[model samples]
Target: MRPDPHFLRGGQGGFGLVAAMFVIIVVAGAVAAMARMSETQNATSRMAIQQARAYQAARAGIEWGIHRALAGESCSDTFTLEGFAVAVQCDTGAAVSLPEEGRSPRFVSLRASAQYASPGSPDHVYRQLSAVVEKDD
Candidate 1:
């Protein structure tokens, strides 16, 4: 009539299996979280690149418009550059009267906007640029 020590040890058998399963679940969760973070980081990087490209396209459009305005050419058009669509608008303002030097100058306003995106995609980027140029009249 003795209480067997082996009986208590038998209950400990399932403990190892439970601990192993818990470790496996924790590792899996960590791996999944890391994967998600990497994806997000990649997406952010891509968006940043797209934004830079759009900005460059808009800046180019603004320069083009300014050049055209200074050359006395009308500026109003849309074009594509580096995978982005750029729109430009430019106009010459009233001439400045300088009586002392007997010279007149005109101010040309130029604006450009660029956009890049795929249809129905959330990763869209846009940029705008404005400039003013002075021309002798």
Candidate 2:
């Protein structure tokens, strides 16, 4: 309702509005950046947990192979655990005779691998392990 003294004279006006707009833009940008950073951190944490789980899965596979070999069975399997794909392969070596000790010893070798996702994926996790055990007759 007041007379437009600055508008008629074409004087500078709306400085407060301009300042408010700048502040809003800056605040919006800051909020977006924080959100992006938080999302990245969350993703990293999930990947780390997946990595550890994959390792455990692979280790379990190795142990399973050793157990089967000790029980006089061939070991080879593919399975899934906790969203991870696990594979184990085993090889049994020829028996070695020990005449001096009156005993024959056989060795079993195992290899295991665990994968959380397809290869080359951003969140993929993988783990591999190898073990050798003595199979006493």
Candidate 3:
């Protein structure tokens, strides 16, 4: 006996239903991936800003140390700024590094470092910077 035409028509629609479901799943996955990418980009930008701030803070420490060194400050001294502590060290002769001859006329070198409490962590972040300054001589 031949099968009913209506039963055969019902079977034909099954392929189209499965294909539609697959397309919907793929679109949802694509959207989820884009959201994750956006979050990562935002995190990168925040890290860059933090690094720039750290660099600036380190520079400030260097400048302060150089000023004190030019005035004949001793080594192992500390300078404080915005809850950060800067340690200064000075040396002379071969022990100390001076600017290249005829470069900037600076005879003394100063090294400064700053330590800050890490954000949302038990650790800390420290940065060091150096500069060469000219003596009154």
Candidate 4:
């Protein structure tokens, strides 16, 4: 007695179901990985922005220090701007008199620093700027 060909084909239907389930699992995993990558990119972009802002704040503080030194005022202060806190400090060295020169000039060194922190993140960003300012005696 020969077996029916239809019965042999019926057993193959389970193989199709297993193959479909494997495909679905692979697609779901790929989607999850993409979501995680997107989230990481967004976080990195936010940190870059915060770092740039902190650098700008530090540069502003350095400019303020230079201005004060040029104006013959005290060049130390602390201030806050746009969620960043800045501190500026300037130090002036002894003036050097040039030989055969009608007028002598002095140079001053200035250092400024700024710090910023995001509300929900534990990371803190810091930037520092330095400059040499010349003043005429």
What would the per-residue lDDT of candidate 3 be over residues 55-106, giving only the tens digit for each residue?
6777876776666666776544776677666677765433334466534333
In candidate 3, which residue ranges exceed 4 Å CA deviation?
A: 1-10, 74-86, 92-106, 114-127
**Model 2 ranges off by over 4 Å:** 1-4, 7-12
Write down the RMSD of candidate 4 (Cα, Å): 3.1
In angstroms, the error of model 1 at 52 is: 0.7
Q: Which candidate is the best by lDDT?
A: 2
Model 4 TM-score (2 dp): 0.85
Model 3 clash count equals 0
Alpha-carbon RMSD, each predicted model: 2.5, 3.1, 6.0, 3.1
Tell me the whole-model lDDT of each prediction, alpha carbons only. 0.89, 0.92, 0.69, 0.89
By lDDT: ranked, best first: 2, 4, 1, 3
The number of residue pairs in model 4 that clash at the backbone is 0
Error of 2 at 106 (Å): 1.8
What are the per-residue Cα lDDT tens digits for candidate 1 across 22-124? 9999999999999999999999999898888888899999988987887778888999887788999987889999999999999988899998886467878
Tens-place lDDT digits, model 4, residues 16-77 = 88999999999999999999999999988988888999999999999999989999999999
Give per-candidate clash totals: 0, 0, 0, 0
Model 2 Cα lDDT, one tens digit per residue, 41-131: 9999999999889999999999999989899877999999988999999999899999999999998989999998799999899999999
Once model 4 is optimally superposed onto the true structure by TM-score, how far is the C-alpha of residue 61 displaced, in angstroms? 0.5
